[model samples]
Target: MTTPLNCIIVDDEAGAHLVLDHYLKSFSSLTLSASFYNAIEAMEYIHSHPVDLIFLDINMPGVSGMDMLEAMPDPPLVVLTTAYSEYALQSYRYQVVDYLVKPIDLPRFTAAIHKVFRRYRPLTPAQQEGNTAAPPPSSLMLKVDGEVIRVQLDSIMHIQSWGNYVKVYTEQQVYLSPVTTTEIEQKLDKLGFKRIHKSYIISLQHIQKITHGEVHLNSGVILPVGNTYRRDLMEYFR
Candidate 1:
């Protein structure tokens, strides 16, 4: 079995720690090594400890979270948390794994962690030595409500935007994931998925019928085609 990812949280606010703690508890793949109310203290702790990830807050006292990252010559993966949107551009310069706004929801929190997991998945010794017997992945694992759900690619018929979350529709049931339509759109695009509207993405393989302004899936799901996407669909048919 692979080792669990160890991570630390550095934030000045107690409430911030509470929120992160609550979310991290649900992840079986991760374990919280330690948490610090000050970034400086956390920096010192990391020097003598092995941490795979870091959850940091931007607006701290001395030795701000960003400053802490600068101090490390090779900082582990980091995810920035703040109430403001202005630091997003600069956070990229720090090479953070993801950024979360304050009062983080379960879905978005899970998504951010999943991003880190996907990017830094540990390769076994055999795989590291150029093993090629394993087949490519045909499904995705989405963490929903503290449990990881494995979703098959071809089983997805469409996705609908539900407020701040998305409802993924397959033949079995609708699985909700915390993300924007465009986020999932990018993931499924290369896998025979196409954006049909601003709020919907449909799997091309599941589409059974199409009209000028709408498309019907084999599951009897009809979705309206957005004006912006109409031209693309026409060209695709041509």
Candidate 2:
């Protein structure tokens, strides 16, 4: 007999917990290890338990779900559950297994869970010894306003900040988001996106020319490379 996947729910809403609980009861292959209303409590439980999957929420009172995920020593497969769809792109940067919008239907939830299971099947002793492979790169989902947009990493040119919002300039179009520059800076830094200035993070692939302390993008936009970021920018150029 196969072992049931040990799962936990970390959501701030009582209704969300109830909804997930009802759906989980229907799945014979799933076992609820615990449920938490906050990141602190959830962190404590996972440290003591062997959890296989996590149904996490994006926005919480004190510590957000994304924050909690970053703090995990060995993060389990995370499926984000949130009402705010705008955070979809940000969550993808964290390598979350999947993103589920709030008011989740049973069918969709089941399908997502199955996808996770299939994607992360446990390796056998021999396969593990042979060095199990990693999963493929995932396309990021960006929610701008009410629309869901999938942006392939290759199409991205650069990201620029305007006050509280960041505009992602892609080959196809530009996406505006109400997120801080620091937040976008942190997410994109590891994904080959370099901060050339306080206001600009350019995709290293789309940079066409660097001259006079400015970066010329493939799209013909010239962005200033800030003095603070100049040292790293010069190194990347070399």
Stretches of candidate 1 off by over 4 Å are 123-238
> What does the lDDT come to for candidate 1?
0.82
In model 2, which regions exceed 4 Å deviation? Answer: 1-13, 16-121, 125-138
Q: How does each model score on TM-score?
A: 0.52, 0.55
Tens-digit lDDT track of model 2 for 134-191: 4433334444663334578778888888898889888988899766778767655567
The worst-scoring run of ten residues by lDDT in candidate 1 lies at 140-149
lDDT of each: 0.82, 0.82
lDDT of 2 at 236: 72
Q: What local lDDT score does residue 91 receive in model 1, on the 0 to 100 scale?
A: 88
Clashing pairs in 1: none
